[model samples]
Target: MLTAQATSTAVSATDIAISLGLLVAVYAVLGLLWLFLVVREISHGPAPAPAGVVEEETLPLPSAGPLLRPAGGPMAGSGR
Candidate 1:
């Protein structure tokens, strides 16, 4: 009876090990599939530049306001 019980326990342990092995294999296959999809996306082309490549001379900006006020204030046209 003792030997039979030991044999049954060994078979149960082997079954558990096989189940765990199959689970690991399934997860590995899923991970590989995800990696292949991500690689396919990155293999298309180069990404856009972080800084713009346009020249400032080609597109001049507007000038800022002058230091003096307009010619219609309380101190305007008085020459003071």
Candidate 2:
């Protein structure tokens, strides 16, 4: 099988170094921005809940009706 090789004139050390430097610079900038955003969020605390909302259920749930009935009552599914 034939193989491909880089010709000296086609790819120069200066070009490679420039691209590598640009890549590193881009990543470094993005990392700093992400870190800044995280620190800012941490400095702020959790938001407050809206007023007038009940902490617990004010009405019984439909499924709870069967369980909450008096024990002596006829069986739930019985025709009686």
Candidate 3:
């Protein structure tokens, strides 16, 4: 009876250890896959601009028209 009990305990321990090892291996594989994907993305250059999307050569600034007024209104002899 004593020998049988000892054998059962050893088998249970081994099973638990194997289960933990398999869990670790699964997580390691997932981590490696994620690392590979990140590396691939870095190696590839930035994605191209969308089709038919136009980018301006230079940003347009507000024209110096009547919209630009000083704190004391238009300057003297500078046309209102």
Which candidate tops lDDT? 3
How big is the positional error of residue 54 in model 2, measured in Å on the Cα after superposition? 7.1
lDDT of 3 by residue, 1-80 (tens): 68756565545777988999999999999999999999999999779779886656555756775656655666545664
Give each model a TM-score: 0.40, 0.48, 0.49
Clash number for candidate 2: 0
lDDT of 2 by residue, 1-80 (tens): 33345446687889989999999999999999999999988888666558976656575567756667766765565665
At residue 56, what lDDT does model 1 achieve?
A: 58
TM-score of model 1 relative to the true fold? Answer: 0.40
CA lDDT, every prediction? Answer: 0.75, 0.77, 0.78
For candidate 1, write residues 1-80 as lDDT tens digits: 68756675545777988999999999999999999988987897666546877655777655644425566855576775
Which 10-residue span in candidate 3 carries the lowest summed lDDT?
A: 71-80
Q: What are the root-mean-square deviations of the candidates from the true structure over C-alphas?
A: 17.1, 9.5, 13.8
- Candidate 2 lDDT score relative to the true structure: 0.77
